[model samples]
Target: MKKRVEHGLERFIFSSRWLMAPFYVGLIGALVLLLVKFVQELLHIAPNILSLKDSEVILAVLTLVDLSLAGNL
Candidate 1:
């Protein structure tokens, strides 16, 4: 009887780990949103590249680099 109870408890603990699935799914959704924003930013910058000031261009480049670093993390 003690061994059976122990086995059940172990199984319960293992199954409970799956409760984190939703959190992972949410993170993946966030990543997809980030990618979409990144692409949108690129499109926004491409059209006005010639007219942008040097500081504005630097800021845009840094924003892209920051997003890339975030995706890697």
Candidate 2:
């Protein structure tokens, strides 16, 4: 009986891997987009950091962080 239960559990885990495959692929794509956006933000800031108001800079930074978190999820 114990052996049967173990065998069932093993099969269940193997099948579940297929369900998670898409999730892994989506996470990788999101991570790549996040990296691209991060670089874009840096470029935008480099020219205006001194001229832009502090609040504007803060807002852009917050947006970058939000994108990173969403990608991680």
Candidate 3:
């Protein structure tokens, strides 16, 4: 009986791997968005680096880093 119970529990755990598929997909989507945003920010800064305040650049970079961390998680 104990062996049967262990076998059932193991099967349940293994079957649940599919449940994480959606989460991984969502993470990929978020990573793509982050890449787009990073590129946008770079484009925005390239033309008028002097016009953009230092804080603005820092904030944008920080946002990119935050998105990267989220995607990695």
Candidate 4:
């Protein structure tokens, strides 16, 4: 009886791994989307950099950094 319970518990724990598969896939997707946004933002800001104030450039970089950190989390 004890061995049977152990085997059942082991199986249950093993199967639980599948529950996190979707979460990992979602994170990957989020990272990809964030990357695309970062690139787009860079392209949009590149030509305007000379005219942009220091604060404007800082805000744009910070936005990109925030998105990347969120995707990592």
Best by TM-score: 4
Q: Could you give the candidate ranking by lDDT, starting with the highest? A: 1, 4, 2, 3
lDDT tens per residue, model 2, 1-73: 9999999999999988899889988888878888898889889888988888999989988888887787767
Writing each residue's lDDT as its tens digit, candidate 1 over 1-73 gives 9999999999999999999999989889988988998999999999999999999999999999988888877
Q: Which ten residues in a row are the worst by lDDT in model 4? A: 64-73
Global lDDT scores for all candidate models = 0.94, 0.87, 0.82, 0.91
TM-score, every prediction? 0.73, 0.72, 0.68, 0.81
Off by over 4 Å in 2: none
The residue pairs that clash in candidate 4, if any, are none
Model 1 error, position 14 (Å) = 2.3
Instruction: Give one digit per residue, the lDDT tens place, for model 3 in 1-73.
Output: 9999999999999999999999989878888887887788678767886777899878877876776676577
**TM-score for candidate 4:** 0.81
lDDT of 3 at 4: 100
Error of 2 at 42 (Å): 1.7
* Reference-based TM-score, model 2: 0.72
Decreasing TM-score order of the candidates: 4, 1, 2, 3
Tell me how far the alpha carbon of residue 68 in candidate 3 is from the true structure, in angstroms, after superposition: 4.8
